[model samples]
Target: MDLQQMRYVVAVAETNSFTRAAERCLVVQSALSHQIARLERELGARLFERTSRRVRLTPAGMAFLPAARQCLDAAERAAAEVAAAVGEVRGRLAVGLIPTVAAADIPGALLGYRRKYPHVRISLRVGASEDLVEQVKQGSLDVAFLGLPPTMRPEGVAAHELARDRLVAVVAPDHPLADEPAVSLRRLSSETFVDFPAGTAGRIQSDLAFSAAGLSRDVAFEVTTADYVTRLVGPGLGVAMLPSAFAPQLTGVVTIEVTDAPTRVEYIIWSRFGHTPAAAAFLKALDIT
Candidate 1:
């Protein structure tokens, strides 16, 4: 019938005495007796056989005892799971990211988080800033990294600026422009460029940088990944522009500072929906506290 009735049935079955069971349950003897009687009536079966001096189980009581105990155990487990989902720092965490952040400090931060909490399951997804935002909003990801432009405000999601990585020019190690210690947008106006697709976050940065210098970037290729820009540049395919951090890991590519006033802002973006322990730990290690 109810949890109290089930508990009374278990107590009576274990103690085999209404008086002792009432004492164990911290209820009056009459209350315990009434609860068990109500349960038997609801079940349409005699659960206990009682004499003036002794108490024993009917076939029904024996059958019902284990099920009653199981119900109580299940109820407790449900509560524990809800609590774990709310506050505990363990479980599966799906993270999404824009290319630059994924290629930079995020991997190292995740490695540190894995060392600290080896049991938490972690998964990563890569997309543009706006796409990652949509994934988080749709519950496809728990956290993400983004670089929001001045025109964009991350809606329905929590965001924090983790770092500011300046933009740079990347070229094949032996390319003529690679010899410059640092180059300006004016110097790059004539170079064939490899860049992000027309309407993505990285492309917005490139467009803004060129606009600020009143120069047009010559387009020879369009791609989606920052790493591909590196690999393409290695073959002297064309010059690429990307975040400075992204260039460090790219062998056969030379990184030169873009002598421009504007730099892209890198951020640790995540859904306001919440974070699993592992994702939160990785964010903390990134100094996003």
Candidate 2:
């Protein structure tokens, strides 16, 4: 099958809806369906089981999916190598950034890269570190800035350390624990806490620290952004544990070091293979080998 047909199949598999897949692929539904039908005819098997309510991949489709992805990846890598040979770094670069770690010169680095390679198109996605890492692993993102706990290591990706920051507790200035030089994890077990959502890197580190101290915290508020957590704590809503880099300078909030808190290591991560020339240029701009 042609690369276009393979792309259509992959899109349909990912979206699980021919109509939505067509929309994503920027083609009409009939055209996409025709391609898939042609592909299935050539293979002599049904790739997807279609129903009124949903679409599911058949056994043949499941078996073909990985090979299809590999083929596409290889084609892209070959194109990138060609572009590199010609000394051209012009292509779409999809990069993911974690909000908590986005402040650590990543934006500046991207700006410089854009200035140096104006023809290169860049798309930036902001999300939780775990989600961003997943995007990188899935090949949707060329690279990602992630905040990882020291105890948690990523697999199947190349991680370059960007920065290391400690986790700290934030509270209202008049709060009972605001004056403390440092707070232990066990001391905040009973405190009402504002925190990042579950499964995020920040939340994972906080959970692990509490669990390690044999203490549990009552998370009264959960937000997706560290800035919002800081704002919430500023209004005396509750205390929060966030990366020290995200500690805000708001009027009512005070940051206290967590004596036993986990270290949040920021990393620039990419897939082990198939990075585009633009991605490599961006990494070079960031001083990553």
Candidate 3:
């Protein structure tokens, strides 16, 4: 019924444990439980189903959660706006990025943003492209960096296109294909591959390219992080196709230009409604708008 009660509910839902939620909110478990119980009584609905081992949101809780999150966001945005009026940007900035983000220098950008806006608190998460986009749209993240096939664009949000590049094949130094300056999707398709899991945005770019060429790849190793792919390929276990911008950063792999490769477009996305003061300044710091 109140913001504090809603915060407790949100925390409990996210952490999936009353004890952990209490720790996150810097309160004791009993007080947090009492507040949520009081709120549930006021709302005439049970928000969570509790058990000895686990906590799960009830139907009513799931229904209440989105509005509760929006209310919280509104309250935070109001305070941020007041600070903005005084030419100060002090608030939480939650940023999400794909691990292979190449269009912008993420760590360097955060360093500069921190130096310029010392009052703001910042947090970062690395996730899949689609997951980051959804987090930005859901109000969990203020901004995100994403990369997808050039044919697609993030829907229902405001995004700035950062750059685009074709993917390159990476192989070990003594691998048969390593000496080649250039290869084709078809050529790479014949080798064992290490790649992101199937159906992920990063994985799909290569999947579609080979599918279109009427070829199939043998993805022997499925790993989430690009660094893992590099490690796998470094031992001559399998080959990987990575973004041109990203491939040069690795030391063990030899980058061979793919004659016919999938093109990926990088973007910076934020809410379409408006930017929070911290997000606005951060984007502006990068000359995005």
Candidate 4:
């Protein structure tokens, strides 16, 4: 009738003695007898034939015994699986990153995270900040690295400022301004600019910088990735602004500090859905405040 009743029946069938089976089940013999009597009465069939000397299974008991054992076995396995999922520290986690962060310095952080948490599998996806933020909000990603403007937090998501990287002017080595220690926004205002796409964090930063300097920027091309923007600048496609951390790795492009640009805050974002241990561990590797 119920799992406990089924367990009693199976235990009695195995031990073939009410006294000993109740001992194995940790119930008094009389309590065991009452439970089995209730089960047999509900089924309207005798489960065991009893004698003064011993107990033996009835034909119905022989047919039902294996099924009862199988049910208990399945319930046990389900409980164990649920416990493992709740308490164990191993599973797959999906992470997203804006192209700028992935290009600037994520590999070393990820390598350290993987070394410490070897059991956790991690997959990396790269996209624009807007796309990665949407992925985290929609639960398609466990966490993401993105640049955050001062007032753009979405509901049901939490973000922490992980690091800040400075934006600087990027130009081909042969460009006249490339030799300067710093480039003023006024001097570069009319130059063709390779810009980040609209609605992205980098583009917003560029817009703010131009606004601060009272200059209007001329857009030559729109790009989605920092690496591509730097590469394009090297070929004289246009001048660009990029995070200074990308300077050492970029070939043929010279980066000069933008005298008036503001520092951008890089963030680690996750849905309110709660971060997995792997994502949390990865955040720790960044040493984020």
Give me the displacement of residue 216 in model 4, in angstroms: 0.9
Candidate 4 clashing pairs, residues 3+ apart or interchain: none
Which model, 2 or 3, shows the larger TM-score?
3
Span of ten consecutive residues with least summed lDDT in model 4: 75-84
Give lDDT tens digits, candidate 1, residues 114-135: 7876666779998988888887
Cα error, candidate 2, residue 34 (Å): 1.9
Predicted structure 1: lDDT: 0.78
- Relative to the unseen true structure, what is the C-alpha lDDT of residue 91 in candidate 4, on a scale of 0 to 100? 56
Question: lDDT of each model, Cα atoms only?
Answer: 0.78, 0.85, 0.92, 0.78
Best by TM-score: 3
Q: Give me candidate 4's TM-score against the actual structure.
A: 0.65
Per residue, candidate 2 scores C-alpha lDDT tens digits across 195-239 of 888877778988888888788889989998777887889878999
Instruction: Give model 1 RMSD, 1 decimal.
Output: 16.5
Model 3 bad stretches (over 4 Å)? none
Provide the TM-score for each candidate, comma-separated: 0.65, 0.80, 0.92, 0.65
Ranking by TM-score: 3, 2, 4, 1
Q: Root-mean-square deviation of each candidate, in angstroms?
A: 16.5, 3.4, 1.9, 17.5
Candidate 3 structure quality by residue, lDDT tens digits, 82-148: 9999999988899999988898899999999999999899999999999988888888899999999
Highest lDDT against the true fold, candidate: 3
Screening candidate 3 with a backbone cut-off below 3 angstroms (N, C-alpha, C), the clashing residue pairs are none
In the range 119-210, model 4's lDDT, one tens digit per residue, is 66779998877788888876668788887555455346787776677788889989988889997888889789998887677788878878
